[model samples]
Target: MTASPAFERLAIVGIGLIGSSLARAVRAEGLARTIVCADANADHAARAKAIGIVDEATTDPAEAAAGADLVMLCVPIGAYADVARTIGPALKPGAIVTDVGSVKQAVIDAVAPHLPEGVHLVPGHPVAGTEKSGPDAGFAALFPGRWCILTPVPGADEGATRKVADLWRACGMTVERMDPGHHDRVLAITSHLPHLIAYTIVGTATDLEEHLRQEVIKYSASGFRDFTRIAGSDPTMWRDVFLNNREAVLDCLQRFTEDLTALQRSIRRGEGDALFDLFTRTREIRKGVLDARQA
Candidate 1:
């Protein structure tokens, strides 16, 4: 495989799972001559450096971004604006500013105003992740076979967007261009709603009678275990995602709740046919997910 042009330095703000993973991938593929990371949590920055994930690690975002060819924001959506403000003055002219934030429009709105005229803003989301957080949770293989969506604002440089896309492709992702609003709507169903449900069920289980709670944990198998895994994701990141995508998530939630009520009514009325029909339809949905390679 041919190697892409190496960035002089790739700065990653927020040395968490995604950030550290990007660091590893960049180093492993020789995509950058240097990888620098910054984290609000000083210990995380120190840890990333100690583990050799980044050539330089700092607690200040400006220090990390200064002189870098590309800078990727990997923090929670809520922190994007603050990070952008901190790094704006430090970014080099023509530097590409991108992000791996799950919610695209909010991030774009938050970061765009702070960027200098010559700096490029290419908002992106790697439609891939796990319930884990922190630098240690990252691995180079995390991005392989996943989709990376870039939502470039009007008048943004095409060359910058292509460079970011090329970086993700080098890390083993399939790159796609998408509208921010459309991306938000799609993720509301595919990602957000599922996380909300997982959190809800896990929270409900915790409120059960003490003995029942213990039993639930002891007996949790396939489905419940899966929910638990999702519930374990970084609270800060997931919370920001929900708040940033509130409208889309709430719209999806309204439909989901009505469908759930119907299922509840079917079970209460002992309507086997109604229950079976719903179950059959849901099974078909599951099959579609499997066919799409997303299940």
Candidate 2:
């Protein structure tokens, strides 16, 4: 016998990598009775319906959100406010509005005011994804063994929060709760800074002479290849992330610059022991991440 669904109806705004993956995961686990995907890009909505990832797909955010018990905003961070505004009136009473945005504080700040009084805002970030986009890039396996962080506002409905947590757990993720500001700062170091560095390194390579550029790609099986992969992430999404989480990302970037400068000095001075010690410490950090299966 099929078990009952956790959500009466789930509205997914922005059916890209994360959104599509959520639809797939929810369906696989029978977490939502109905999955409605809304993307401003008509092609995305059409493709989502065609692929049978969603019961319905629409370009109108409000229309998709009208009867949904849970509405997840999966668009870029910059679009949060606009989406919230559009869907504000459509959201039913006691509805739980969550998100898959990487930046947390900005999401709350942008989306909170627009939501109706009775609707609960529970922002979330599923800290798992690939350097891919669009409806076709998603899969149910993306949520398993991953972490899902929820940043509920003060005085948030406990039942609503638990419901959201249970949904993620059903999708095979470990759920965590945190303050949105702290989540942003933590993610800045763990996720955003790395992406920024990757983009910078890859962009630098793009400016290399034509001959050197070809050689770089030809022999990119080294670390440069990994950076290229990270840099290939959705441009609009990353741009919005950096813009939305500017304070946290800038803080982390400053510290990273200081560390990088020290490394550069050590290299210039031929301080092999200092470089070796630093590398050894970083190696341990990588090992710890691997142990945690977060890498």
Candidate 3:
């Protein structure tokens, strides 16, 4: 006999890129008996259903969440509490509520208290995405070969955590468990800081004189082009990310500023050796990334 699907009903809130992508992935993997989505944007909710990635779609979080065995919150970090509150009453006992936000500790802070007893919260980060948004931008292949981190609070139900991990595995991600604080610190450097830098650089370019700005775009090198792509990500999402994880991001930013000041001093003093040493070390990190097949 064919095995049963992992979840009887899967509900996804925020049918934007990640949310729609997850719905597609779940359908592709046959991991849920039914998939439904709710988006604050009515157009997005309708588009998700029109595209047939979900069995049903609504503008109401509670409506979508009712009777769902799994509820995935794909909204921005700032909206977590409100969404949780709206869906808490609708969530049945024993339901698993998880998220794809980059910040973990804040998610738990916002979502945990609102969840009814017996409803498990398994905070997660898929560690994948592009500078894209909206329901049309998602695809089932986005999770393949990427990492998905789960940050279950102490005393969380082990079975719920395993089921969420299994869902990501079925969607083709390699899963790892992490402490929420550690996950925030790690992502602060690898993802958060980089995006911050990109936004700063791109914002600087936009502030240039009109003629210079046009010229910058006309003759843009690969580096500036790459920064533009990163900066092109949804503003609401990144704003929530930076705000929610301010402490870690600010810590990383301070260290980066200090390092940058040192580099400036080296250049001003004509210290080629110091520059070379720094470049050599950073190059090894790049090589390591490539070696790990993550580049």
Score each candidate by Cα lDDT. 0.93, 0.94, 0.96
User: Which candidate number maximizes lDDT?
Assistant: 3
* Model 3: per-residue Cα lDDT over 1-295, one tens digit each: 1689999999999988899899999998889999999999999999999989999999999999999999999999999999999999999999999999999999999999999999999999999999999999999999999999999999999999999999999999999999999999999999999999999999999999999999989877856999999999999999999999999999999999999999999999999999999999999999999999998
lDDT of 2 by residue, 1-295 (tens): 1867878899999999999999998888888889998999999999999999999999999999999999999999899999999999999999999999999988889999999989999899889999999999999999999999999989999999999999899889999999999999999999999999999999999999999999999999977999999999999999999999999999999999999999999999999999999989999999999999987
Q: Is candidate 1 or candidate 3 better by lDDT?
A: 3
Poorest lDDT segment (10 consecutive residues) of candidate 1? 1-10
In order of lDDT, best first, we have 3, 2, 1
TM-score of 3: 0.99
Model 2 alpha-carbon drift over 4 Å, by segment? none
Model 3 residue-pair collision total: 0
* lDDT of candidate 3 at residue 227, scale 0 to 100: 92
